[model samples]
Target chain A: MSPRDLAIKDLKTHDLTMREAARASSGARVDLLLIAEMVRPGSRVLDIGSGDGELLELLATTRGCDARGIELSREGVNAGVARGLAVIQGDADIDLADYPDNAFDYVILSQTIQATRRPKWVLEQMLRVGSRAIVSFPNFGFWRMRLDLLVNGKMPSTENLPYRWHDTPNIHFCTIRDFVDLVDEVGAGIERAVALDASGHPVRFNLPWAVWNLLGEQAVFLLSRKG
Target chain B: MSDSDTTSGEIRAFEPARGEADHPHSAVLRFGADMPLQLDAGGVLTPFQIAYQTYGTLNAARSNAILICHALSGDQHVANVHPVTGKPGWWETLVGPGKPIDTDRYFVIGTNVVGGCMGSTGPSSLNPATGAPYGLDLPILTIRDMVRAQAMLVDHLGIERLLAVVGGSMGGMQVLQWAASYPERVFAAFPIATAARHSAQNIAFHEVGRQAIMADPEWRAGRYLADASSPRRGLAVARMAAHITYMSDSSLHRKFGRRLQDREGRTFSFDADFQVESYLRYQGEAFVDRFDANSYLYMTRAMDYFDLAADYGGVLANAFKATKTRFCLVSFTSDWLFTTADSRNIVHALNAAGAPVSFAEIESDKGHDAFLLDEPEFFAITRGFIDAAARAVGVN
Candidate 1:
């Protein structure tokens, strides 16, 4: 059989529209945009777990930033390459630290900090290899999540916290405050911060700490070398 | 179905029937059905055929040729109609006209590795001597064996030297091997998102996948091929397990995250309630239908055994000693599987060996699967490298 036929068949059988697949999480691209904005034009950017190179392409097109991505899925990589993006198939846990120090202007780790085994170590490596970094993760301390856990007595499973107890890849779930404390402990200086609400709107128009954990549900941070 | 040689000895007949059916113009070519593959323990494989595919026209000089090697589960169909799944080639992004590899400018060749079941000689091929599939009787193969088989095919086409050789993952392993074993034969090498040796953790992952495939009840002691029953569930499970290792933890969070699949409420059962679970299940299910289970075992084993430095007196540079083949080693920042450190290791070795090499660790969020994506940085790098190499070799 021809590959075109197979792709068509697979598309028909397993075709989930972008909105359906992304679901309510489509707003996360806002976080991606925030990360891109952190980078200056001509700065080299590395998005460790780039999905389809969307953010990297955005950076390149919008800011003329040079971006490189590493993805693990053949289909995702193929999609990125189809869009004329450059992506390599690989795993981040085993591959990220191999990069030399100060190789990039900004190393963005958006929304994936919770799933890593060694987020602190990964962060340290990112700081070591790049002049600046962008780290974002869902705020497990959101009132809804805390209320869900307090009221229901189980691991919260909502739009942002959808995984069940057994199968969830969120190995290191943390709240906005917890991550802030982590950045301090690691001695990485915070340059700027933004926390978006569930509706994808910005929270804490002025002071970040006041509305970070209390009002805004999701947390996004920009960090740099402390010294 | 046959053509006769005229006085000029160049009698061309009707447009040769090409593709799937048993014909001369088929992309896949089968051989060694008569000989049994002798295993390490003296076990024997009766017969087998290897599947392969070719793209672009072979020029009169045949020197303007490039060979593409596929990763695990990839078949000979690099940029053509896949026979089983009937898909439109896997690397169409890099191999089409006007693309980086540029099929219009280079006669591209791709083929199934020795242990693959697509069309190349593999455990699934029939043993002509016994009229039975080779099964476990096929000799265990290493990266060198695959390269050797490919070398034979290149010779058959009357090509002296290749303009360039490219691949990623396991395919990159083959590219490295080609440069090491036949330095005089390749002009340029692109080994993306791959490593010189499998890490201990990666070996553990492969072991887990192998165990998964072997544990399936349908495996039936490797005789499942004859019974028309494959260890599909096991293979699916194995694929699902391995698929997780292919992405950055960041990618999973960005993609499935803690999100639920379909319904708003979690059913709270062991069923696929989360989007991640459903996604994994889909990956596994789709994989089994298009791939042969035995081929998985062989391919994974081949990946596990790839140790280029070990073969060259414990010095990775020794493998590339005195070779003029220009090398471009690319790594993604997020690809933990073969890390940028891995590429640096290759670069260091090439530097030590005095080989002309360039290394780039393109920043990307897509994790390890960055080379196949649409990163302009990667495209520019590839286009630059290929253009430079083409000029170096006087190809275009």
Candidate 2:
């Protein structure tokens, strides 16, 4: 695969929408399955940056949920529609504000949050449209990412962050701690959290936030607005 | 052998210039005064007929039937050779034996709308009472009335639910009407290059076309048939003007580029100097032969009065509330007539109504006419959406 495809693939293991190329590959993606688990069966769902609608299809068929998506590229939107899914061409930064509040039961932003220009605004919009928001991202503070940056004194690039420093689509890279802080600042609370190691397995079940932030290469969270 | 059967005194069979009464390629279903059609214009049409053509075979389950609606000037000959012009079907690029809308798999039915001048009942059809053409006396038709007429035909064919309804432009309006009027009967709708309501600019253009036809002395207040005259020039000019909106500036530039028509130098006269001018004249002349002046007036008026949202208490979403039909709307970048923004507005309303909908604004410079051309991306979307909807409805 090309570097761009590699970056998107690396991003997809956590974000169901970014897994454009990996959408056709064998078994269910671990992170997408994880996000799907947090969603209540038969609930309405809105998947942001839903590239080609692989996860939306999974949600609709497996959970019997009314699933829809907002994608940025027309190519992705058309492809998703071809699969007989309700996906429209829209941007995460702009179009979310147009949706009515509480329209969906769950609003999901998978591996794609890191690529957004305003993660905080997008999180708030997702929360506004849905009662619950599920987000997953690659943890920038992972041991390997940290070691590579600290020792090489260069921008860290790994399996999770495959793009070179210049061409990376990730504009707002955030560690698990950084994301948690943003969630709190946005007046939301994490209802459930799972940190995954490099191989996509849950890491250090009983460990503290700091330990999980360092060891976990990626993370998924279920969030809700504060009462 | 003559298409003049519909014009003869005391004639019962009404057909277009290119359609002969004995042609086996199409069929017409007649509904007498007992089975009257309710019109949106607070009038009723009796003793009407719907002309249609069927392609492929109907499956035993009756679930494989697809209805393909035609645009303003199109007729029932969707995938067959035109009996008049001897040209391939207007949508020859999309619907054929092995095309995206595969005739080998699905039974496709194309209908000449009620207000159309084809073999269908329209202003051109002879009035049974007067023994003369209906002309302006025929009750004004709307998109909904056309759909109701189609519903009767579907009932006549013994199909309770259609597998899908597809069209572009004016036909797209009919598709929207189908989804809104009888949501349960339509499994899927593919409306391309259309808007929920006619734009003001479109109304203005239609007005120009109407005025041109009415201005002609030959038109004789839409009683040209009684006067034994045809408003050929007036109708041709109207067609010439409307045809400009169907193509893009870039396409026009590329196709003609201010080039002279069959001459190296200007003639210094009004005789078709430019290639574009020559092309538009040919289009106008060709249209006049196949279309009726009075039918053109009613068709444009119906389009101008169409406002889907107005009927649903001022909310477009209300028109599609709880609709189970799957929808796929396609638009082209260069289509300024009915733009991508128009398609988006419909998509937004569908989303608000919780309808399963997909929208694609294909990249093309072919303007509004792109939907009728060989667009591969559009073909793929049509094939994919139909195939998927087919599976959902267990058509196979």
Candidate 3:
């Protein structure tokens, strides 16, 4: 097993609760836990493009949040529903408009914004439907990816983004600095931001956007609408 | 030979059939003069009977009860051997021991609608005042009327609040009606391949079937029982036409195509030259054996009269205003009869009402009838929603 699995096994052996074991085990995706941590307990949440409902399950089971999901694929929606989560088969770009304004306390898009056709519009919709929004995505400007592109003369393929250039669903990829600029353009206030390195460890940067863009492989942000 | 038999010798095709109205395989609930059912089409029905079949055990809290509503042609024998056809029940694919419905965990109840022929007070039953078949005399029933009678049955069973109400097609309409009329009484609803109201195109199809049945000389002006004749051919043709609408072009192409029925090549006379024609002939022939012609007219008319949004000041969301009932609406991608747009309309209304709802448009070429078949994704959602709802309500 991987080192993460061994640590989770050790946590389970030490009689941690299922939620703790789950949180400790890295069972839910790393970025999903980060999003879940940002949500207040017992808040209403909607997860767009919630593949298999891993984050919804985390929010509901651990935080007692009223979690719901929208998935684009029939297979993904059915899989989420089979796991006892309330999810609908719908497109993130189209179906998000159906939900009323301020319907949820927190609207989340984790590791999925890059795949969205209109990232700014989706971010605006998330803020419209929820009092707060949480978004996480792989940063395209990590040093290793830049190095690979410079030396190998090929499109960057790092640990966080392993997809081939042609078949990748990440059509609108952005660097950390680029996302921060887009967030500002959409009149959003970033209340909290975390930059994580390759090993799922937060870089703990109080530095500039350029430094975070070059160092962090992934980024998560908690935002609210600015008047 | 008896005088009645001799008089109607040529029309002996009926089953002699409406016999189930009295001697049915289900548990019958009879209403006396004290319990008159008020219908939406402007009158009341008295001394009626509701035939229903039950599976599993009602929990001590009665919170495990699930009421299953049958479609236009279905009856209460939802998960048993049909008494007339001697075949498996209509929804046997979804409801049985260890099935997705899981009889071991749910007290599932399937009831024949108020206008249905199978042991229910329908057009085929005897008129208590006249001692002849009610026929057209039975007050017109609506989807609301069907659900109203079902509410009575639920009350009779001592279930104040049902854990869930589920169905497909016309049955799904009734499920929506339940959500609207008795919102507090239902905890969850599973409506598959359904809509809030019957579409204009659907009404047109039903009209075609109605005309076919009415045009038959054997109909005797809807008093066929009094004339001792049944419109077998007309009813069969009606079923055949409606059956075509229930399937998609792709599925039809896959199942029957332009292939010959048997014999290598076609004899090409006015015979069953193609396999599809032969198959339709079989369907129509088998349908007339078990269904009542007059009941067909009543069921179709009820569907045509359904318009829930019109009743609520032209707003569909108003019908479900502040409803606590959890809803899961599903549609098939190829169901032209009740397309995915219909399901989305309901989803939008529920979203407007701020009700908890989930919707899915499953990919299948089997058309509207896909809900009745063994589709893995459909079954998984069904089982999961029920399981999760059970946990929410604290049902063991």
Winning candidate number (DockQ): 2
Q: Please provide, for model 3 over B1-396, each residue's C-alpha lDDT reduced to its tens digit, 9 standing for 90 to 100.
A: 000100111223444557676556678888878888998877788888888889999999999999999998899999999877789999988998899888999999999999888877899888989998898988888999999999988998899999999999999999999999999999999988988889899999999999999999999899888887889889999999999999999999999989988778868699998999999999998888878888899999888888889989989999999998888889999999998999998998987787878888888999989999988888888888888889889987
The deviation in Å at residue B183 for candidate 3 is: 1.8
Q: Indicate the DockQ of the complex predicted as candidate 1.
A: 0.02
DockQ of 2: 0.55
Number of the candidate with higher lDDT, 2 or 3: 3
DockQ of each: 0.02, 0.55, 0.49
Which order, best to worst by lDDT?
3, 2, 1
User: Candidate 2 — which pairs collide?
Assistant: A15-A111
Worst 10 residues of 1 chain B by lDDT: B9-18
Model 3: residues >4 Å from true position, as ranges?
A1-26, B1-15
Tens-digit lDDT string for candidate 2 (A44-68): 9999988988789889977899999
Please give the distance, in angstroms, between residue A83's alpha carbon in candidate 3 and its true position after superposition: 3.4
Q: On TM-score, who's better, 2 or 3?
A: 3
Chain A TM-score for predicted structure 2: 0.87
User: How should the candidates be ordered by TM-score, best one leading?
Assistant: 3, 2, 1
